[model samples]
Target: MRFIINILCCILAFSSCTEIKKYHSIHAGPKPIAVVIERNPGIRVTGSETPLSVLYENGTLIYSEQSEADIPFYMKKELEPEDFKILKNEICMTEKFKKLRNSYNLCPNILGSTTVEIYMSDGKNSKAVSVYGYGIELEKIHDRIPYPDKNDKLPDEFRRIFRKLTGLNFIEAEKWTPDYIEIMIWPYGNAPEKSANWPSGWPSLSHPLTRKRGDSYSLYMPGLEKNDLNDFLDNLKPKQAVLINGDKWSVDCRFVFPGEPLWMKAFNKMQ
Candidate 1:
């Protein structure tokens, strides 16, 4: 009878484990639990880039930074489970952070600057803050904008939270490999004098997969080959236009980091 009871217990335990695995595989991929994003309207006119930092539910952290030469670099690291637990507890359990109001939007500086946003959610209590601090390069025209000429400082508590999430001093990340590359294309015209020649193997403007996005069209390049991400994007930058098939075209490359849905078209809503 004792042997039979032990066998039954093992069967039940295995069944429970199988169920949990199925649920995780289907529902709990690395959903974006938090992100630090800075959008520069000055960059592409419509403006987009990788978020500065993204913290995922499964302990994944993705970071992107711009080099002194204006080149972009990306890296990723998986936090220790215990470290992620502590960070999540700090964010979710703190009443002040949980109760803070949603937005702190101010207009960016003159000549062009955009909003910086921080968003965190533990499934239920979500905090989204948008801040546009005063730009030191302000001109008289700054007074003419919709936002105030002088921006108010964020309260100290919120300031520390922002710093903590962004300051990944402990994390050491490897090169980021994106799941997809979203390329927004505009027709050839007024092209920059310094432009990268069209890359071979890129889909044509009218490729079947190209979809109309407002005035322009978009194409996605999947990172199939292990080295495709670095190999394909090496010479391309939004600063320089592209001459494709003998025509000058504007191109914006936006990284689609893992676990986040299709380029986050609703990204502005987070602000």
Candidate 2:
């Protein structure tokens, strides 16, 4: 009787393992209809850094940046179905990607500079992964694998999957420029002793005075010319704002430009 019981236990264990394998194979297959990648470069002393968002859905791709009001300035393009199919296949074949853990913090602190969040859905099932810092080192450390290079941006498998999915190399999308630029300025650490002075070299405006809302101020500058925007960006000094805050705090400034989705809403509001 004891010998028979041992045989039954082994069979049950084997059956359970097989079921687990089958479950992963079915759920991990190519099924994502939409993917969104949000990249945050983190804060820098210069305060000139901006976050980026890339969205892929139904063969359409969009790259965007966020404004102060949480509006997005975007550039969009259409993609081929074949290319998307290739990306889906690559992702499904990655062993580590079978069912990503809900969350991962490769490095809790220290040398982290960027955070990437990936969201995917197939109109039925969905998965999300938040990668903190460069993924290469984190993935290795998490899996107890030796790191060949500390500076590697991502694991080989992930790099390939992202390259195919994002189409970073194949982007031939048209650039989108805004008709007018909106600027928002606010205190970062401490309230300013007095009103902050506008940077010099900015185009003179009939209403250059900033409008106060709560503790922050906003300025609207009208210029659609590419060169004009470039000049404004070049002259704007984030470091100066940091100094104005007693060198202890940084100024929060957001530059808003026109783009899809939000662009239409902004235009309608103007009209």
Best by lDDT: 1
- lDDT of candidate model 2 versus the reference: 0.45
Model 2 stretches astray by more than 4 angstroms: 1-53, 63-76, 81-98, 108-113, 124-126, 135-160, 178-182, 188-229, 237-271
Model 2 over residues 1-271: C-alpha lDDT tens digits? 9999999999999977875553333223222343434344554322232224333345555455446997556565566789766655555334565455544444554463454545444444545555556432333354563434543334444545554444443347655553444455555554344333444544223243334446654445543544554554466455544323232223343433222222222222322
TM-score of each predicted structure versus truth: 0.67, 0.44
Q: Each prediction's Cα lDDT score? A: 0.62, 0.45
Clashes of each: 1, 0
Model 1 over residues 179-205: C-alpha lDDT tens digits?
556677787576556777766777666
Q: Cα deviation in Å at residue 214, candidate 1?
A: 1.3
